[model samples]
Target: MASFKKYRVDGGKFSLASIDPADSPFLEGDEQAQRDRLEQLAGELDDLQNLLHAEGRRKVLLVLQGMDTSGKDGTIRWVFSRTSPLGVRVTAFKAPNDDERARDYLWRCHANVPRSGEIMVWNRSHYEDVLVPWVEGWIDKAELRRRYAQIQDFERLLAETGTVVVKCMLHISKKVQRERLQARIDEPAKRWKFQRSDLDVRKKWAAYQHAYEQALAATSSRHAPWHVIPADSKRHRNLMIAQLLVKTLRGMELAVPPADPSLDGLVVV
Candidate 1:
């Protein structure tokens, strides 16, 4: 079993350096065992989601962050396909629109947060404000530091308000990302997903890696810690994420809503 340390809450950050990818016990399991576990976890997730919806006491926010072609969309599609769409919503955060730019950076994100009885997934979340902007020099160092502190406070507030936030950072090697991007370009149907900006970002791979390291270190807190999933293999990544999500949801201790008591003796002819 992999002994993972609980993320520190005082500094409001996660120490990614502490995690060893090779130590992930799930990766060593046989294919059949892995499949069985995945199925079991998926079923439990369905039950938990239904309970959450019916109880309507708390909300869940799943935030996925990764480099280009790191399989954020694929993870969402595969892991969440079986989930009830009515109780779940997905929001993909792209570059700021005019209205978004005019407001505070977190304004647009807050608007899309999950309400009680719903689960919301963020394809790229508020972390981008600190990650991308800081990496690409769009924001200065001082502002970047400020954003980290602000994000921590924001999440603390959300947690205090009955929101469960699960932040995941899909970690893929540079070579793997390159291969995935190439595959997209080679396959006609996937060509539309490829963008020139992707290559530009790829060129600064090291910068992004350092940026991620810093972001995770600064922002992983008890309220919203980052789960760094090894994403080189799509199947393994999906299974791990599913397991983690189900485990977290089950921890909430959700129960089905009770049947209405008003109907005592209604007889059908």
Candidate 2:
């Protein structure tokens, strides 16, 4: 039960003064027990999703942000695989297209925000405008500061409009990331997963960490807090995410809407 702390950027390094995922007590549990709980949580989350969709009163937005090969894909696969696809939408944001670049940075993101009665999972999100661009030095210091404020405002607006935002940052150590990257290179089917750019980014790992630190600090708020889930163990990561999702949705007090009385006596039978 380690407490969560906001991260800050300083001299190209993430400064998390008093937080570390390795200190999480949940990881001390037995592996099999954790997996069992994960399955249970997933079931409850599926139920909650159905209730939310039927109610048609509120929306849920789950934002997953992580480094390349940090298991964003795997998290989606294992944790959300059983949820009803009809009410769930997953959007993976890659580099901006020409049209996206032409408008405001938040334009593409705002357009994809989930409507009431739906659940939208952002693979990567508008945070990228502050994250990647800032780390890569594509934007100046002043611009980065302005974008951070704008992001906070954007999320506040979403919360005000009945969209519950749950942001999770999948955290993996440099050593674990290297092992995963090497495994991808060693396996034939996974070889395509590795790219030269990954190595280039790895070289600037400190810079990326700093960028993430700044992004998390600037965006974490009462309406939307970031959950830094330790991701060195895929099973643990998946379990934590499933548990968090179930808890958040269940706490929202979702209930099925009443059926139409006019249709009650019109059955085909």
Candidate 3:
């Protein structure tokens, strides 16, 4: 199996320039073989999730951060296709409403933390608080620095409390994003998904990229490392995330509780 180490953001010198958005490092064999492998991984993930639920003591939190048209929804759809909804949950963070603005930025995210034995996936997470504010100049350097520290502390709290945080930044190319946005505009069935605001954000792509780079670097840690997935190729994005997830759950060595000795001689009527 291909290792995901190369994709990890190891603090200091890590940057997106080293990764090619179209590269398919995890791809193997031919097209059919790749598809088969993805299905296999999805099934493995389901089985692992069942073990996690049965264990009923620890949890997994997957945080997916990316720019527009970066396949956050697509990743969730395909990766969890075989997993039961009973044990998996998703939270999509949007622009702050008045209620959200009333609290500190992490308030909403802290509320949505996964319970024991559940797998909670964040489509866009608290990182947005920092990214959007910093990019739009709503906050300054001191605030940005403080938020980064607060995020790291927040994740550390989760880690110390038995939640494993898995963060991934879906690194899609600008060209690929343009193609996807155009598809939304041109395809009649997809027109409703298209928003003029998406174009407005697209105009500030470089600023967002810089924001992402800063956020990922500042928050990434041993407790919650960020992996950059080359997402120009959708197959690569799905495969890498699925593989990484299965690997993470497996590493946890989850298991159900031991049977009670009192039941040894008992049989159901």
Every model: Cα RMSD to truth: 2.6, 3.3, 0.8
- Candidate 2: worst 10 consecutive residues by lDDT? 2-11
Q: 1-269 in candidate 2: lDDT tens per residue?
A: 32233321222344553445343444546877777767777778888899998889889999999888889999998898778788889999999999999999899899999988999999999988988888787899999989988988999999999999999988887788899999999999999888978888888887887788777877778788887787778887887788778878988998877787889779686
* Best candidate, TM-score: 3
Cα error, residue 20 of model 2, in Å, equals 3.3
Provide TM-scores for the models.
0.90, 0.90, 0.98
lDDT of 1 by residue, 1-269 (tens): 23223422234444555544323444547888777776776777778889999899999999999899888998888778678898889999999999999999999999999989888999998988887888789899899989999999999989999999998888888788888899989999999998999999999988888888888878888888787887778777778788778878989988877877887687779
Clashes of 2: 0
TM-score of 1: 0.90
- Local accuracy by lDDT, each model: 0.82, 0.81, 0.94
lDDT string for model 3 (112-226, tens) is: 9999999999999999988888988999999999999999999999999999999999999999999999999999999999999998899999999889888888989999999
Model 2, runs deviating above 4 Å = 1-18, 21-24, 259-269
- Give model 3's clash tally: 0
Location of the lowest summed lDDT over 10 successive residues in candidate 3: 12-21
The local distance difference test score of model 1 is 0.82
